[model samples]
Target: MLKKLNYTNGLLNQMKHSIILLGATGFTGKLIAEKLDKDSVTFTICGRSLEKLQYLTEKCTHNHECLVLDVMKEEKIKSVLFQYEIVINCVGPFNLWGNFIRNFCVQHGKIYIDISGEQSFIEQSFMMDKLAKEKGATIIHSVSFESCMADIIASEMLDSALKYSDISSYYFFRNSKPSPGTKLTMQLSKHFPTFFIHNGKMENASPLAFHKYISFDFLPGFTKALFMPYPEILFFNKKYKVNHSASYLMLNHSDAMFLLASRKQPIESVDKILKKHQSRKHNLNENDIAKQEFTLVVQAIAEDGIKITKYVHGRNMYGITAFLVSYLVKQINSGLLLKKGIVTPSETGAWSGLWNVLIKEKLITHVQELQSDEK
Candidate 1:
C-alpha cells in the first residue's frame, strides 16, 4: 500500500501556491512566462541554457528568477523541484522527458502541470493516478488549448445536458496553426494508435475512418475533420460516462491526404527532421496569432430522441493556453483547487470560474446551445 501525506489547508497553500516554469525559453514557455510576469506571479524560470533563460527573465515585466538545470539530471531536477510548490512544464514531445518529471513530482508530493497533448504520454500518466493520490500529488496533463478547451467545454455541457439527455458523441474542430513544439510532439506521436471512447471503454480506431466532412450549425458550409487521439477522451470518459466520444482536427481534403501520405514514411526519420526544425527559433507573430480561431461542438441525444448541440468558439490557441495556465495558478494560489491527486481541469471544480475568466479575457467570444427533435 502506498503511504498518504497529511495535508492541511495551510500545507496545501504552502505546497501548491509557488510556481516554477520548466523549458522557459521555448515558444509556449516564453509566452507562459510573459503572462505570469504580467500577472505579477512569483515564479522561477528554469531551462538548460543560462543565457536563454536570462534573456527571457530580463524581458519579464515583473521580477523573476532563472535556474540552469537539466531535466535528465534526476538529482538536480529533484533538488530544484523541492523548492517550488508547483511546476509548470512547457516541455514538448513529453514522451521523452515527461515521465521523469512526473515521477519526481509524485514522489516528492509536488503539484505538477503540463500542456502536453500527446495521447501516449497522457495514457502513461493515467497509470500513475493512484500513486499520485496516495502521495497527495496533483498531476494535471493536457491543460492546454487543444485538449483542455474541449475537456472543459464538454464537461460543462454534459453537466447541464445530463438532466434530459445522454451524450452520444462529442467532436472538436480546430482551425489554427500549431507551434513548432506542437509539430515536434505530433511527429513523435504519429506512430501511436488513435483511440476513442465507446461503451465506456477506450477503443482503437483507424485515422482514415474520420476523413469525412462534418458541418456545424454555427459555422457555414462543411469542413473536413480528421480523427486524432486526443487526451480529452481519456479525461472525459472517466468522469462523464459518455457512450462514445471522438476528437477531430479540422483539415482540408488535401491536407488530410497529405497527413495520410506522411504516415508512410519511417517514423525515426520524420522525428529527426522535425527535431531539427524545432531547434530553430520560430516565434509566431501577433498578427498571425490574432487570426487563429477554434471551435468545439458537442452532440447529445435524449432517450426520447431529442438531440442537443452546444458550441464554443475561441481565439489564439497559444495565447489562450498561456492565459489558462496562469489562471490555473491563480486558482491554486487562491486555494480554490486543492484536490489531492491527479485531476483534469474539469475535475478541478473551477470550470465555471475558468469559463468566466476566459470570457473576461475575450478569449472566448461565442457560446450557443441548440435543441432539435428527431424521430
Candidate 2:
C-alpha cells in the first residue's frame, strides 16, 4: 500500500493563491521556493521527507505549507491534488520523475510545469502534451534554466528575423556555476538513469550520440568542448526545419565525468560506476560558481541571400536559471497557452514575441547583431 498523504481536498482548495512545489528539499528547489516567496505567491513544499520538508517550510517567508507526498505514490498525489492551481516540479533527473508528476497533474487538471533539463526527460514531457491538453491541464516541460532562456531569446530573435528573413540555423552555448543544490542533483541523477527519457519515437543517442567542435570568442579564439547531443535540440531543429543542428557542451570534471560514466551502460552497470566513483560527502558553498558562461549564437539565413548572426550573453548560470524560470512562470500564468508540445527553445516563438520580458527580467544581458563581414 502506498503512503496516504494528509493534505486533502479541503487543504488543496485552501491553497487558493499558492503553488505546489514538488521536490522541495532540493538545492535548486530551495532557491525556487525563495523566489516564489519574494513574489508573494503562496506555495507548499511537497517531498518525501516530512521532517526535512517541515524544516524547509518553517524557514520560508510566505504562507507556505508542507506535504509528504512522494512522486512514486498515487493515492497521496490525489489527496493533495485539489489544493493548488499549479505544480512546480523541481525534481530531477526528470527522466524518472517527470512522468510521475506530469501524469498526476494532467489527470487531475492541475497545471503542471517542470525545470527538467534532461533531453531524454524533455522528450517524455512532449509526449504528455496531447493528454494534458485533452484533460484541460497546462503541462510545461523544460521550464528551468538551461533551455528556458535560450528558448525565449531564440524565439524572439527568430520571430523578428522571420519578419525580415528566414532562420536557417540556431545554436545556444551555456555555462553556469554549480549551486550546492544543482551539484547534488547531478550526483543523484547519474546513478539513476531511469530518469533518462527514451522512446521509439525518441531514442537515446548513445554517449557522444551528437558531437561538434566550434570556435567561440566568449573567452578567446577557441576552447575545446565535447558537444553532447541534447534532447532539447529537437525543439529548435524540428521547429525551424533547419537541417544542420548541434548543442556543444563544456562540462567541468564532475559533470563531464558523470556524463562519461553514464554513457551506453546498462542500469546496473551505471549504478556500479556511480557507487565506485561518487564521493559520499562535500563542503557546500552558496557563493561558489563552477566557472561558467552560457552564450547563445543564432545565425539566420535571409531569403535575400545573406547570413545574419546575433549573439546573446549571460553569466551566473544558477541565478540566471532561476531568473529565467521566474520569468517563465509569470508569462505562463498570464493566460498564455503554448499549444505546441515538445519543442526546443527555438520553436516556441513567444520569446521572440516577448523579448522585452527577457530584458526586463534580466535573463539576457544583450542581444547584438554581429558584423556579417567577419565570418
Question: Which lDDT values do the candidates have, in the order given?
Answer: 0.73, 0.56
Regions more than 4 Å wrong, model 1: 1-17, 159-175, 206-209, 269-275, 278-283, 302-304
lDDT of 2 by residue, 241-318 (tens): 443444455544455556566665654454553454345554443454334555665555544445556666655556
TM-score of 1: 0.86
Residue 23's lDDT within candidate 2 is 79
Model 1 Cα lDDT, one tens digit per residue, 1-375: 111223243132234327889988888898898998898888878787877876787788776666676787876676567767798998777877788988888887888999988777778777888888899898888878878877776666565334333443334445456778877767666556557776657887755455557666566643776777778877766676556677776665677788778767665765566668857777666667767877766666655777778777878878988998888887788787567777887777655666667788888888777878977
| lDDT, residue 237, model 1 | 65
**TM-score of model 2 vs. true structure:** 0.74
Model 2 C-alpha lDDT versus the unseen true structure:
0.56
**Model 1: residue 329 alpha-carbon error in angstroms:** 0.4
Global local distance difference test of model 1: 0.73
